[model samples]
Target: MIELGLPWVLATLPLPILAWRFLPRAKERRAGALRVPFFDEMIGSVRAGVLGRVKRFGAIAAMIGAWSAMVVAAAQPSWVGEPQSIPTQGRDLMLALDLSGSMAQQDFAVNDRPIDRLSIVKAVAKRFVEDREGDRLGLILFGSRAYLQTPLTTDRETVGQMLDEAELGLAGKETAIGDAIGLAVKRLGERTAEERVLVLLSDGASNAGVMDPIRAAEFARQAGIRIYTIGIGADTRAFGGLGLMSLGGGDSLDEETLRRVAETTGGNYFRATSTEGLIEVYRRIDELEPSEGRESHVRPMRALFHFPLGAAFVLSAMLVMAHVAGALGWNWTAGRGR
Candidate 1:
C-alpha cells in the first residue's frame, strides 16, 4: 500500500502556476542599446529556430511535470507492506534454573529410567519454553552465582538451547537461590509494567552467594515480579536387593525458603519428588500464567520519495541541456556568418 507522510506538502504543487498567472512581471531593461556585429546572422538564426508553439507548449508541460514530481517527493511518499501480528499484552517471563553440584544427583526418573536432576530439568524446561508462545522468555542459570544465559527475547529457540546446554559448575557447585532471584528481579524490573513473571527451579536452599533469598524475594515483590519457586529432589531412592531406603530425598531440599520466596512475590512454591511431579508443577504454573491472546498489527513501511525526487532531477537536467543546446546553435549560426 502507498501512503504519504507529509501530505500537506502537496498543497505547494499549484504554486508555480498561480505565480505565473498573478505575480507582477519585472520592469523591462531600459539600458542604452548596443550594436551587434552579427545582427543579421542572429536574426536569421532566430527565424529558423527548432521549436514552434508545439515545442513551447512541451517545455511548459515539462516544467509543470517536474514541479509536480518535486512536490510529490517533498510530501514524503512511502510503501507499506502487509500487516504483521505483534503481541501487545504479552508477559515478560524469565526461567531461572539450578545448576549447583547437587543438581547432578540421580533422583528424578523418566520412563522408569533413572536420570539426574539437571537432565530432567533440561527436558521439561525445553517443553515449557515451547509452550510459552507469544511471550518473551529468558534463561538464567545459577550454581554458586547466577548468570543470565539469555536476555529477555521472543526467540524461544535460543532460550531453550541455552537452558539445554547448561552444565554443572558453570557458576559453581553450591546453589545460590538468592543470587538467582536477585538476577531475575533486576532483569524483569527493566521491563515495562506488562505482566512480569519468573519460574525458579532448584534442589537446595541458599547455601552460597552473597544475597539472601528472602531479601531478594522482597526486592522482586517491590519490582512487581511474580516468582514461582520449585524445589526438586526425590524423597527416597531405590537400593538393589533392599527395599527403597531413605536416600536422594528432600533431605537437602529447602522447602521453607523456597515457599517463603514464592509467597513474598505473591507466587507459589512446589516440591517435585518425581519426574511426573516436576512436569505437573510446570503444567500448573502454565495454568497460573497463561499467555495472553490480546495483540495488535503493524505494517512495515519503506520510503518511496526517491522515485519522484529522481524524476524531478532527471527532468530538470534535460531542460537545462535543451536550453544550452539552443544557445549553442545560435552562436554557431552567427560564427558561420562571420
Candidate 2:
C-alpha cells in the first residue's frame, strides 16, 4: 500500500495563497505623463491584448501545477510492502566438539558400516543444526586448544559445512575440555543470560590446556551458560565366547569430568555408545532448549518522492519554453509589419 511519511507537510499547500492575501505588496512607482506624438502608434503596435491575457493565465496554471507537484514530493510518499516474519529472540547455542586423535575411533556405524566418532558427530550434528531454524548456532573444534570454527550466526548451512570439513587432531592430539568450555563461555557471555547454551561432546579427559575442567565449569555457571556434556563411546563389548570386556580402560574416555561440567551448569549429562544413541542425545537436547516462540515482522518500504519531483521539473521547463516561443513569435510579427 502507498503511504505518506510526512503527511503534515501537506498542510503547507495553501502557504502561497496565504502569503499573497496577508503580506504587504511593493508600492507602485508613479511617473509624470509625457506627451508623445507616436503614443497611439505604440499602443496599436501591441494589439494582441487577448493573446497576452491567455499567456498570463497559462503561466499561472503552470505555476500552480508545479507547486502542487513540489508539495506532493515534500509529503514523502512511499510504498510499503507486505510484512515478513522474523525471529525477535532465540537461543544462542554453541557446539564444542572434541577433535583429539581418539575421535578417529570407528565405534559408531552407519548402514552397518563402521564410521569414526567425528564422522558420526558431523552427520548427527548437521541434522541437529538444520532442525534449529531460528536459533543462532556456533561451532568450536578443540583438541589441545580450543578455537572458534564458526561464530554464532543464523547461517546453519555454513556451520554444518565447517563441522563436516573438520579433521581429527586439527587442534592437536590431546583433548582440551576446559579450554573448550572457556571459549564457549567467552563467546556466549555477550548474549542474553537466559538464552546462552553450550553443548560439549568429548570422548576423552582434559589432559591439555591451561584451564581446569572444574574451574571452567564454574566460570560457565557464573556466566549463566548452560553446558550439556556428552561422553561418547561404548563402555563394554563381549568377545566371541568370553565375558564382557570394558572398553573404557584407555585415558580416552572421561565420564566423571564430563558429568561434573554438566551438573555444575545445571544441565544434563548424556552418554552415546552408538549412532542411534547419539541421535537420541541431540533430540533430547533439542527438546530441553526450544527455539523462541514470539514472532516479529517488518515491512519493506520504497520511497516515491522522485516521481512527483520529476513531474514538477518537466512542467516548469515547459512553461519556460512556451514563454520564450511567444516572445520570439511577437518579435517576428512586429518585424513583418514594419
Candidate 3:
C-alpha cells in the first residue's frame, strides 16, 4: 500500500495554476529591449504560427508537470509492506540458577551417562530458553552472591551461551537464594506488570545473602513478579546397597523455604531428582507461563519521494537548457546578420 506522510501538502498542487491565472503580469520594460533589424520576425517565430503556439503550450505543460512532481514529493509518499508478527506484550522471564559447590554433584544422568547438576541444568535450560519464541529471557547465577550473568534480552542464543559458560563455585561456595530472588525482582520490577517472571533453581538452602528469602518473595509479589522455585537433587540413593550415599550429601535442599517463596509470589514449586525430572519441571513452567496470545504486527515502509523529486529536477533542467539554447541561437543569428 502506498501512503502519504503529509497528505495536506497535496493541497498546494493547484497553487501554481491559480497564480498563473489570477496574478497581474509585470509591466513591459522598454529599457531592457535590444535593437534588432529582425525583432518582429524573431517574435513571430516564437509566438505567432501554429508550431509556435504548440511549443508555447508544451512549455506550459512541462512547467505544470514539474510543479506537480514537486508537490507529490513534498507529500512524502511511501510504500508500506504487509503486516507481520512482531513481539509485544511477551513475558520477560529471568532464570536464576545456583552455582554453589553442591551444583558439582554428579547426581543427574543423560543418555545412561552420569553428569553433574550444573551440566544437566545447562543442557536442559539451554533447550528451554531456545524454545521460548517471543519471551525476553535473562540469566542470573548465584552462589555466595547473586550476579546478573545476562540482562533481560530478546536474544535467547546469547543468554543460553552465557549459561553454558557458567562454572561451579565461580561466584562462591555458598548459596544466596534470597540475593538471587532480590536481584530478579529488582530487574524485572521496572518492566510491565503481569509480564515479569523468574525461575529459580537450587540444590541447597540459602546460607548466604543480606536479604531474607521470604522477604524477597514478598517484594516480588508486590511488584507483580511471579517466581517458580525448583529444588533440584535426589531425595534417595540411586543404589540401595550404597547406604547413606544420597545425591548432594543426602538432600541439603530447603524444600519448605522454596515452597513458601513460590507461594508468596503466586507461583509453583517443583522437585527434580534427575535430569528427566528437571526437564519436566521446566516443561511444566513453560506451559503455566505461556507467551502472550495477543497478536501484534508491524509494517515495513520504504520512502518513494526521491523518484518524484528526481523527476522534477530533470524537467526543470530541460527547461533551463532550452532557454540557454534559444539565447545562443539568437546571438549567432544577430552576429551573422551584422
TM-score for every candidate vs. truth?
0.59, 0.59, 0.60
lDDT of 3 at 275: 69
**Clash totals in order:** 1, 0, 0
Where is the poorest 10-residue window by lDDT in model 1? 238-247
For model 2, the stretches where C-alpha displacement exceeds 4 angstroms are 1-86, 238-251, 293-338
lDDT of 2 at 76: 96
Q: What overall lDDT, based on C-alpha atoms, would model 1 receive against the true structure? A: 0.85
User: For all the candidates, what are their Cα RMSDs to the real structure?
Assistant: 12.7, 12.6, 12.7
Clashing residue pairs in candidate 1 are: 101-173
Q: What are the clashing pairs of model 2? A: none
For candidate 3, the per-residue lDDT at 289 reads 93
Candidates, ranked, TM-score: 3, 2, 1
lDDT at 333, model 1: 66
Q: Using alpha carbons, what is the TM-score of model 2?
A: 0.59
